[model samples]
Target: MNFEKIVQERYATKTFDGKSIPQSEVEKLLEIIRYASSSFNIQPWIIKIIPDKETKDKLSPASFDQPQIKSCSHLLVFCANKNVSENIDKLEKLMIANGSDPEKAREYTNMMRDFEKGMTDEKKLAWAQRQTYIALGNAINGAKSLGFDSCPMEGFDSDAYAKILNLSSNIVPTVLCPIGYGTDKPKPKLRFPKEEVFM
Candidate 1:
């Protein structure tokens, strides 16, 4: 489908059919998310894809008992990585391995490090959380492009999710995206006028 159609038809799915999306399609959606743009190319996010009913059941209460949590085929927990400098280090190594000049890579890494140094711990987490939203945007839109439905959600307990998922302290659960075939239909497209929004 074209980009316009994807955007027009995509909605926050309320319920799903409980049928699994093809693994290949899910992988493609992951790749699309991986390619999403991020500030300084830090890519400060890790996604945990849960595809089993047992785990979904465990997560439902944490998600306010949202129907989408248990009904969806795959529940994606987008975690923001708080270790920004570590990712910058890894990116620098990748740059050099991919034929970038050593001097240029060092310069890039140093710049990222300098920028990271200016942030407090709170700022760091906030920045990482913001970057995760970019990936979340790709995820929901990408799911539609790949012939599935998705719901972008922030109605879950992050601390509970982290404990249930066994995530490290540095990985913060920022948002959720539940994907599958929608059982419910869209109501209508409601939006502000183009002029109002554009201005």
Candidate 2:
């Protein structure tokens, strides 16, 4: 499908059919999300994919008992990684490995490190969380492009998710995305006109 159609047709699926999406399709969707743009290309995000019913059941309550949490094929916990310096280091190595000039790679990564040092812990989390939304956008649209359905959610309790997922202190849960086949039909698409939305 074209991009226009994908955006127009995709909806926040309230319920799913409880059928499993093929692992290959899931991997392709992950690739789309992985390539989401981020500030400085630091890519400060870690996605935890939950495919088991047992874990989804545990997460449902934290998600305010949302049916999407349990009925979707896979629950994606998009976490903001606060370890900016660590990712910069890894990116530097990857660049050099991919035939980038070693000096240029070091220069670029050092610049990113300097930028990272300017942020406080709270700022780091906030910035990283914003970046996760970009990935979340790709996830929702990408699911539709892949012939599936998705719901991007922010209603879950982040602290509860961090504890339940056994995530590290540096990994902060920022959003939830559930992917599956929608059992519910779409309501009318509502939006303000471009005149009201854009200057």
Candidate 3:
């Protein structure tokens, strides 16, 4: 589908049929997310895929008893990786493996490390969270492109999710994307006038 059509056709799915998206399609959607851009190419995020109904049942209460939690085929918990330095090191290695000069890779990674060191702990979490949203954007749009539905949700309890998922201190759950075949149809697209939205 064209980009315009994808954007217009996609909606925040409110409810989903209890059907699983094919594994191949799910992998394609993940590729789209993996390519999402981030500052410094640090890629400071980890996604936990929950396809088990039992876990979904456990998490729904934390999400205000939202129906989407249990009805969706899969839930993607996008977590911001607080360990920015580790990602920087991994990126440097990837660069060298992909034919970048070793010295240049080191130089780029050093720059990223310096930038990360300058941020406070709070700043690190905030920055990572912001980057994670970019991935979430890709996820919703990509779902539509691949003939499925998705809901980008922030209504859940983050702390509760972290505890339920047993995430480390460095992994902070930032957003949720529940993907499935929607039982509900999309309403008409509503938006402000183009003139008002664009400067």
| TM-score of each model, paired residue for residue | 0.98, 0.98, 0.98
The residue-level lDDT of candidate 1 at 106 comes to: 99
Candidate 1 per-residue lDDT, tens place, 1-199, comes to 9999999999999999999998999999999999999999999999999999999999999999999999999999999999898899899999999999999999989999999999998999999999999999999999999989999999999999999999999999999999999999987999999999896
Candidate 2 lDDT tens digits, 1-199? 9999999999999999999999999999999999999998999999999999999999999999999999999999999999899999999999999999999999999999888999999999999999999999999999999999999999999999999999999999999999999999998999999999999
For each candidate, what is the lDDT? 0.96, 0.96, 0.96
Question: Distance from true position, residue 117, model 2, in Å?
Answer: 0.3
Candidate 3, RMSD to the unseen true structure: 0.8
After TM-score superposition, the amount by which residue 180's alpha carbon in candidate 2 deviates from its true location, in angstroms, is 0.3
Root mean square deviation (Cα) for candidate 1: 0.8
Residues 9-106 of candidate 3: C-alpha lDDT, one tens digit per residue: 99999999989999999999999999999998899999999999999999999999999999999999999999999899899999999999999999
> By summed lDDT, which 10 consecutive residues of candidate 3 come out lowest?
181-190
